[model samples]
Target: MAPRTPLFRPNAYFATRSDVLFLGLTVFALYVVETLVLFYALMYLLLDQIRDAPPALESAMNEVFSTVAVFTVFIAVVALLVVAAIVHYGSGGTDTDGTFADAVSVAGWAYAPELVTMPLSYLAARREIATLTFDGSDPATLQRQFEAVQQSVGPASFVILLATVVWSVYILAAGTAGTHDVDVRKTILPALLVGFGSFLLGVT
Candidate 1:
């Protein structure tokens, strides 16, 4: 709960228009960078397949990339809106009154901590992938390398990863509570689902 991070008191801090705009734009920029990296990696993998492709086929491939890029950007915003709507309507029954705005801001701002967590998650994945690469397809050596990597996560990194996840989840839960004006007890399901979704997205 860093003071400047804004998750500590999401309800109070998000009241201003400027805060909402800033957080939204910052997260959006991060999302753009994330998508670019993913698509670039994808393109690298597909480059050889297209090297001898016909001119018409190359043009079609370009169009496909454009379509997918646009679709991903649309999903970037739509995902948050969907989460907001879900939490707003999904909260425990009637007396839970909160604005759609509150839910949207909370959903977007809650992902701020992913700036720290996703890279760590990505690196760990790459290491595991590296360990599994086959030089001779020997089962025993591959198993040993996999086990070594499974145990190789540094203690400090693990603690940091766990802390960020908890911090992010706490922010999500607190925001959900604020959104519903309900007790933490009522927000558990939404909190856990959102938190798990975030983790799954990052590691993927």
Candidate 2:
């Protein structure tokens, strides 16, 4: 049974499958934030590399493009999963009569959270979590230090992965059961999802 008073009456389709759609949208939002934070971070590191060696211009460009491509594909896969889940839930948890448009729409909102979160973020905190910079005079030593920074990305990324999962579950539950009507409840789920999502992304 639908709520007597609609909770923040969304677009026509949103009302019909709010639970699934919201969850999908939230995760997609998180994904975009994670991607963007990574993009900026990569750009920052690449700039540093260029600063260190002006002669390696071609190599730097190639490295930047290759790195971006790999991460793009990785994020695309995550987006696909969110879209699929949305479609699965939108059609009342079955693929029997799902529409491609439904999934596409879900993917569209993924970028919204990034716009909202990026400006307000504490860049100082994010920097502390992400990078371990060294300014030693020896090239070999700096290279090793860079390698160490790269290695740390994995453990950092894993922690972010865990945060994203937990936040997803929490937001889904809140949006579904926190209030019969969506407009009134002080839903903590969205904030948690956004905060943790942004943090993980900032670190990445």
Candidate 3:
């Protein structure tokens, strides 16, 4: 039997079945927190653009609830995909030395990279939003201000976004490879496809 590894080290950890439930719960919680923080930051940006914005406490609360529902659905879909991938590849003569539970656990931990990047991205956006001067009464002025805000944060935000995505893809690839006993190269395409699919799902 292979030795067990710490859950924090997903590449090695997914190979073992120890603490799968705990790790999945932890990842789920982290993902929720990350998503909430991201949406809050976005709300701050949007609210900042309104010159005479109405009291938004209620609206913000509504948005939070809606976002939670969306993220819950998104995670569920991703979990199903992970299970399908494991089953399909396992039947293809590949030595996917792990089970459905292991794939789901790994998929959960695969989100760890975002724990770092999401908060940083939110901070960057928050900072840029703070610096913007708003004139929401005039649509053209508001658009220009929004554009300026984007330009101010665009480069750094893009870099962080890109790096986090690549980091996530790398983590997912490693988790898939280790859990499935497949070549790292074999996992790359699947990881890219999954990542892209998830992004599309999130946006829509």
Which numbered prediction scores highest in TM-score against the true structure? 3
- TM-scores of the models, in the given order? 0.59, 0.44, 0.69
Segments in model 2 whose C-alpha atoms lie over 4 Å from true places: 1-13, 16-42, 49-54, 57-62, 70-74, 86-92, 95-104, 107-111, 119-122, 125-132, 135-140, 150-204
Ranking by TM-score: 3, 1, 2
Q: Residue 15 of candidate 3: its Cα lDDT? A: 59
- Tell me the tens digit of each residue's lDDT in model 1 across 1-204: 224556567544543333464575577568566755655553433433232334454466577788878888788788777777666666663556666666776777766776656666566545444434432245465446435644555554465566676776676667667655777666667767766775555433
- Across residues 80-104, which tens digit of lDDT does each residue of candidate 2 receive? 5554354334334332333444443
Query: Which lDDT tens digits does candidate 3 get at residues 50-86?
Result: 7854465447557766877687668755665564464
Query: For this target, which candidate reaches the highest lDDT against the unseen true structure?
Result: 3
Quantify all predictions' global Cα lDDT against the true fold: 0.60, 0.46, 0.63
The C-alpha stretches of model 3 lying farther than 4 A from their native spots are: 1-9, 55-95, 134-153, 198-204
By lDDT, the candidates rank as 3, 1, 2
Total clashes for model 3 = 0
Worst 10 residues of 1 by lDDT: 44-53
What is the lDDT, from 0 to 100, of the residue 187 in candidate 1? Answer: 66
Worst 10-residue stretch by lDDT in candidate 2?
4-13
